[model samples]
Target: NAGVTQTPKFHILKIGQSMTLQCTQDMNHNYMYWYRQDPGMGLKLIYYSVGAGITDKGEVPNGYNVSRSTTEDFPLRLELAAPSQTSVYFCASSYSGGGYGYTFGSGTRLTVV
Candidate 1:
């Protein structure tokens, strides 16, 4: 009840469609991140926020967006979905960056056709 939670465990999107991958946490963490893992590859950071009202881009953020309106919520938005965006999205949070381990949600598997 006090960890990360992601909605829509699986999803399929048509070309040019859009959706928001919902992520929330009850742990009151200040650091949150969105990562996408392609098949046979490691996780690539998409976006991250150090605290509420502050956000920054990560390694891969061209097709994604994120907002940290509050301490518990960090939603990932996919606008004009493309096949290249197909991947497993993971939402994670930590009390602070480094040292402390992150709590990750189950993940959202997205496929674009």
Candidate 2:
């Protein structure tokens, strides 16, 4: 089973263009997260969902949104995408909170002009 996967591994966006960063997991994880990593940088939390039907904003949630209606999928929506939003977005999941290292998808490198 694929642990987690992200589509369109790379993307280029013009200012104001929107895109959805796809993410999914097959490990039946209950905690899913969307994080962005700048070039040669650390991961910054964007949004997260603890379980189905539950979601919350994270450290960097501006211009982005997320939903977790099921246990497998957690897609990140980028609305009114901006140049500042250009970064490597990584979708991750963990079976336990703060105890286990998150399983991260390869990543989606987004460039906004």
Candidate 3:
């Protein structure tokens, strides 16, 4: 089964263009999160959802948005994308917290210029 999947593995955005980073899971997990990784830094949570129809913003949600329409999907939307938003976007899910670790997708590398 596909634990997690992310579309458009690599993309380049114009100064103001926008795109949606797609994420899907087949494990039926209840906790899903969107995180962005930068060089030499740890992942920063952008948004999360406990379950379908319940979404929340995370530490770095300013330049992004997210929605959890179903248990197996959590998509991230970037509106009026900016250069500061350039980073590797990762989609993850877990049945529980850190004790169980997390299943993450390969990540979508985004570049804005």
Which candidate model has the greater TM-score, 1 or 2? 1
Global local distance difference test of model 2: 0.92
Residue 63 alpha-carbon offset, candidate 2, angstroms: 0.6
Tens-place lDDT digits, model 1, residues 1-113? 75999999999999999999999999999999999999788999999999999999999999888889999999999999999999999999999976799999999999999
Assess candidate 1 and give its TM-score to the true structure.
0.97
User: 1-113, model 2: which lDDT tens digit per residue?
Assistant: 88889987999999998989999999999999999998667899999998989999999898998988899999999999899998999999999856888999999999999
Query: Which consecutive 10 residues in model 1 have the weakest lDDT in total?
Result: 97-106
User: What are the root-mean-square deviations of the candidates from the true structure over C-alphas?
Assistant: 0.8, 0.9, 1.0
Q: 1-113, model 3: which lDDT tens digit per residue?
A: 97999998999999888899999999989999999999998999999888899998889999788888899989999999899999999999999745688999999999999
Candidate 3 wrongly placed segments (more than 4 Å) = none
* lDDT value, residue 88 of candidate 1: 97
Where does model 1 exceed 4 Å of error? Answer: none
Models 1 onward score TM values of 0.97, 0.95, 0.96
What is candidate 1's CA lDDT for residue 42?
94
After the best TM-score superposition of candidate 2, give how far the Cα of residue 46 lies from its true spot, in angstroms: 0.4
